[model samples]
Target: MSSKSINISEEAYERLNSWKKSNDESFTDVIIRVLPQKRNLSEILECLEPIDEETAEEMKKAIDDEDSA
Candidate 1:
C-alpha cells in the first residue's frame, strides 16, 4: 500500500496514541477507527443536549412518533 506522511501537534499525536490498540496499528488506522461518525443534520437539530426541558420533551415525542409511524 502507498503511504503519505502528515504532521500534527504533539498533543494531538498523544491523543491518537492513547487510543491506538497496538504497535502493529498505524496512526492512520487509529484515526479512521476513532473518528466521530457524521450526524444527519435533522438528527443533530433534534438530539443536541443542554436543550431546554420543554424542547427536550418535544424532541422525545417526535422520536417516539417517528418510531410508531
Candidate 2:
C-alpha cells in the first residue's frame, strides 16, 4: 500500500503507541480500532445502550462533583 508520513508530538505518539493491542499491531490498525467511524449523530445515538436509573444517577453525581470541585 502507498503511505504518507506525518509529524505528531511525542505526547501524541505515546498515546497512540499505548493503544496498540500488541507489538504486531500497526499504528494504522490502532487508529482505526480506537477512532469513531464517520456517522451522523442520530445514527450514533441509536446504537447507544440505555443506562439504568441507578447508573444514570451515579453519572450525574460524578458530573455534579466535578462541577463543584
Candidate 3:
C-alpha cells in the first residue's frame, strides 16, 4: 500500500492521537473506529429522540407538502 502526506491542525492531530487504542494503532485505524457507520432507515429512526405531537405533525406536513410538489 502507498501512503500520502497531508497536513492537519495541531488540535486535530491531538484529537486523533487521543483516540488511539494503543501505540500500535495507526491514525487510519483510529479514524475508521471513530467514524459513523451506515444504518438502514429503521435503525436511523430508532436512534432519534421522541418529538412532541406538534413537532411530529409539523414534520409530517412538511413532508406531505414536499411530496405533493
Best candidate (score: TM-score): 2
1-69 in candidate 3: lDDT tens per residue? 787799999999999999999999999888878998888999999999999999999999999999999
Tens digit per residue, CA lDDT, model 1, 30-62:
978988679889977787557799998998999
Better of 1 and 3 by TM-score: 3
For every model shown, the clashing-pair count is: 0, 0, 0
What's the TM for model 1? Answer: 0.48
* Global Cα lDDT for candidate 1: 0.87
Candidate 2 local accuracy as lDDT? 0.96
User: TM-score for all predictions?
Assistant: 0.48, 0.62, 0.50
Q: What residue pairs are clashing in model 3? A: none
Ranked by lDDT, the better of candidates 2 and 3 is: 2
Candidate 1, superposed: residue stretches over 4 Å from native? 37-69
Write candidate 2's Cα lDDT for 10-44 as tens digits.
99999999999999999999988999889999999
Among all candidates shown, the one with the greatest lDDT: 2
User: Any residue pairs clashing in model 1, and if so which?
Assistant: none
